[model samples]
Target: MAPSSPHRGVQHTLSSRGLAKLALRFFSSLRPTDCPLNCLGKARLDFNLLPLEGELHCLELFQWSLLYQGSKLVATQQSSQTGLQFLHCVMELQKKGIKFINREVESFKNIHLKDGTLEIPRLVILDTAMSLFLNLGAFEQCHFNCGNDTTTYLFFMDDLIDYAEQMRHLHNCGIMRHGLESDAEVADFFNQICKEMVLVSSRSYLSYLSKDVNTYFGNKWNGWIAILELKYFSNPWSIISLIAAFILHLLTLIQTLYGVFGYYRPSS
Candidate 1:
């Protein structure tokens, strides 16, 4: 009889060996920004799961976009009172009745719309973690509204767009290579992410992306905000200064740990 087939876990483990090497060798190299996308609008996004102090871990969103004709990094509207909002143009299309489409999305249409009459469907954005993975598979970039007030964002579109340009340049250079050392690095760094998903039953890895993206942005932003808020604190300068100093040191430590130390954020 032929050799027994590799168990799903074994296949995952084997596939993961390459990723593990990637992790040991280059995992921490993942940019603080977002994952890169390909010329075909294929990209992987991550939204780390951020748990709320209260109870529910709400799904957070990020954005994916493409650079049109020239090498342009598109900009979106921002507001301090609200938060980071992405895909305004696409969101507008919802008003015109365009529907977002994807598999594994619940009864709701894939596009962010409430009423699905389709004539520019109103943006019925669900706070679903699954959207991130699905969106990455579907679109080049996603639009995100992040930060407390929500104006802050983690835009993956530009990263992928930039990668696309680099790929084109490589293609022309006679040094064009099919596999990217960088993406391999990213995929490796994000191996834990993929591993976590494989452990689950969800065939669609998009939701995990949302979950990862959410956690990453939420924690980083909150940390920054706390740091910023402490800067102006003046009730008892000494006490505030002490606390602020600790926070500042922690921030730098985390950055350095992930940056210099590689592959570990030290689990804040």
Candidate 2:
């Protein structure tokens, strides 16, 4: 009853006022101006959620948030065929006991397979998307392989995740990790990333992976069987249903044969 906590009331009021002023100032600075990146002529800057900062752009903030939150930008739903294919190829490579080494040394040798093991240098994807891209460009300059594996993977992922729906598709299939708050964030990450990634169309580690995937899909029978396997084994219920169907079919065939033989029994 000592002045009824006046200090606490004052502190709360000050905090609220400060936050309101910050929000107002932050929102007021955003302009819907065209991008300075000449290549993207019609694209406009939309600062709906984030505030404008010098050299600290939206993509940087988004990526920082993603890493800070220890979140993986995953697909909330199934991804497109291209996305699935790309992810599948990576998984296949991983399954093949491939080793990715993140070395400080600059080596041009991109993809090498020896003794049923594949090795490729790793690239770091950090909070700074632009910086990460610039570093990759530098890598292309120094490394003999060019920005083959890292850049190609970036473009491949960028192509796969054009929207939230496709991101969800990959997530649903366990191919993507969910880290961002929403699918839109995941899509936006790639959209902005692709815009920054200038390197495209070159040999990389993924080239062989891409070829293998295309070849696998090119075979109609193999593709069909893979689809069937995915369809039947993707979920336990489907697997149960498939097994039940097979059992029922077998039983029906056996009963039909028995009846036919019994009906044609020789009179003894």
Q: Write the per-residue lDDT of candidate 1 for residues 132-234, one digit (tens) a residue.
A: 4343323321222221111111122211123344333323332122333453332232222232221111222123333333343345554454455455443
lDDT of 2 by residue, 1-268 (tens): 5566888866765565455435434532221111111222112112222232223333333222212211112211111123223433334333333323322222212334343333433322224444555555445445542223445556666754667776665555444544447877766776776675554443443455455544554556654555676679779999999999999999999999999988899557
Top-lDDT structure, candidate number: 2
Question: Positional deviation of 89 in candidate 1, in angstroms?
Answer: 21
Clashes of each: 34, 13
Models 1 onward score TM values of: 0.17, 0.44
Error of 1 at 168 (Å): 35
What's the residue-level lDDT of 158 in candidate 1?
17
In terms of TM-score, the best-performing candidate is: 2
Model 2 off-target regions past 4 Å?
1-127, 138-149, 165-181
Model 1 scores a TM of: 0.17
